[model samples]
Target: METAMSDIKIIMKETYSKLVTFKRKENRESFNKELLKVLPQIYRYVSKRLNSAVANGKLNKGMFNPSDFTDQLFIEVYDNIDDIKSENELHVFLFKKVDELLEDSLVEEEFDHVFFDNIDTYSKPEWDAMEENYTQDGDGDFLLLEELDDSSLDKTNYTLNHVFITDEEKKLADKLDASLDKERIYNHIQLVLDKMNLPMRTVFELFTNEGLTTEEIADIRKTTLDQVEELLASARLLLKNSFEKRFLIDSN
Candidate 1:
């Protein structure tokens, strides 16, 4: 137990280190300094998975890397979008190929070795600290989905409207409602992006350009208003969350 506690403290320290380093206004300057350390491994895995997929032809050449579509990915893509988008699509296409391979291959074992192996080393206490410090920001600007009134209107409604989807989008959105992990929605959005094959710039342009109502987004997606509301609610949770994670709180 003591060893576990010590590991937890290390996790907490590392998590806090990332959090505090990111809190600097010039975070962009320091961005990827530490994060880049872990990215190559992820990048390599994605590349390998993608290369195998291209050989299998299960995916188009332009699929995005759905597995690696994290906020960190956004930062990486934002700079050289053309290259990144193409790479992402190829990566995603490959991911589909690998998904097919999973049926016959020991992909689960590989995943366990790659991602899940050290995950157990992650202390729940460290995760709690990450949630408390990295997400909640020692400041109080953070708001959970449950904290928002279902009836309330905010800038977030516009943000949610941007995630275009069909009836199929609802199931993923529902899963997101059940669990507020930003990572889940991030992955779901990547899935949608893969389905649409839309560029990040195009999506970002659409999201920022037009303001959307909960009603309008629902009509566009052909889903019920309630479902749209749920989607929007989940989106709001992510928007605020991404902001807090990437920038310092602006509670003023």
Candidate 2:
């Protein structure tokens, strides 16, 4: 793991050096070529944000494309890359710019800001009904499950062991963890995220889906590290509580 990380650092350093050289010469072609290497991550972030916004009725699906945002971002990078001092800074700059674009496009008037804070209060039958609905909707994608699994927090595999689990609940959590397939869990998680406010969802996705550190997420969101940490913790706890309520609690 250490070796692989070291190799990544080396590669990033080299990429940065090349970018600097290209910047010095005003070499748009080479600079863009190098910049495109990071576009897949940027594209994925934009795509997810757009999908979420569209899903929640914040945006018209036909009005924008992920590529439109990416094209504008590349222009912004070309003009402002000189201001970036380091490779890591460049990475954060790209996300920050794209986030700004998304926020601007998604006006405040469109936001409903719904949050499902009562997951624990939900009855087992209610959860089961919701689960059945989610299954019928088939909203969860396997790729999303893979992305959630790859996060540092590993919320996808969260067990009741982390919460105040009684012995029975612990056994139930273990049993459910083993029995519940990836798609079901991912679907439930998606439903949970959809109910959360944008900041919490963005923080969770930036950390889990984008593989960004808390500090980077803070920079991207223009918030404090403590706030970012809090959002992430809250998001994870919500997922855990919702999962326990839906699957671990006995339906009497």
Candidate 3:
């Protein structure tokens, strides 16, 4: 149990120690050994955080693969390794930078996706077939002539004006079509999730994605179990509201 709490910090301390002592163009082999050993853990942490951030528009798909971000993180660690001072400090510092960089990258609001592409789908042959063959049954069978009647024909005879893809209908489709670029949706979600304070984000990712228990998270963050629970709840609520807005779903 205690080991779970200190696992990341312990690895971080060891990794930071190696990185701090590394001289440029010297001890390359030793540094590479340490780099390979710690890369997965660091990458996993960064990836999880970025995954969360990308959903809220805090990052783009390009940054979803955190290999480049992980490199930047390592460089930051190396430059400031001596100043980090402790394993816990390094743990907080490493991921805080990840969140900060994402937040800092917000330059402008992406124009909301205006879905003009899907409006034409209504005019496609499949929909046209429905209008043309309104008398057709589910089995692709037409109404028998013997069964035909004035009422039956009237029900089956759908006029173009009734089923036509009007300009007004297209405008409604545009309004109802919440379809944004897939990547943009992700980016919006990432930005919303990035609103979480770093500690809450860190603990939430550790608990959810890393399979760490709340107790373990409290241990990792050096906080009480109750505090961990609160942070988790706070993050959940923050995301819940953002998700509701994004998806047009309601918790209410």
Q: lDDT by residue for model 1 over 76-113, one digit each (tens)? A: 42343233233223223322333333334322211113
Q: Which candidate is the best by TM-score?
A: 2
Candidate 1 stretches with Cα past 4 Å from truth are 1-16, 24-26, 60-252
lDDT of 3 by residue, 17-92 (tens): 7765663445755665565455554555555555444444555556435565656765666666668776556665
Q: Cα deviation of 5 in candidate 1 (Å)?
A: 18
TM-score of each: 0.22, 0.74, 0.42
Query: Would you give me the overall lDDT of model 2?
Result: 0.67
> Between prediction 1 and prediction 2, which has the larger lDDT?
2
- Each prediction's RMSD over C-alphas, in Å, is 20.2, 5.8, 21.1
Instruction: Output the lDDT of residue 67, model 2.
Output: 73
- Higher-scoring candidate on TM-score, 1 or 2: 2
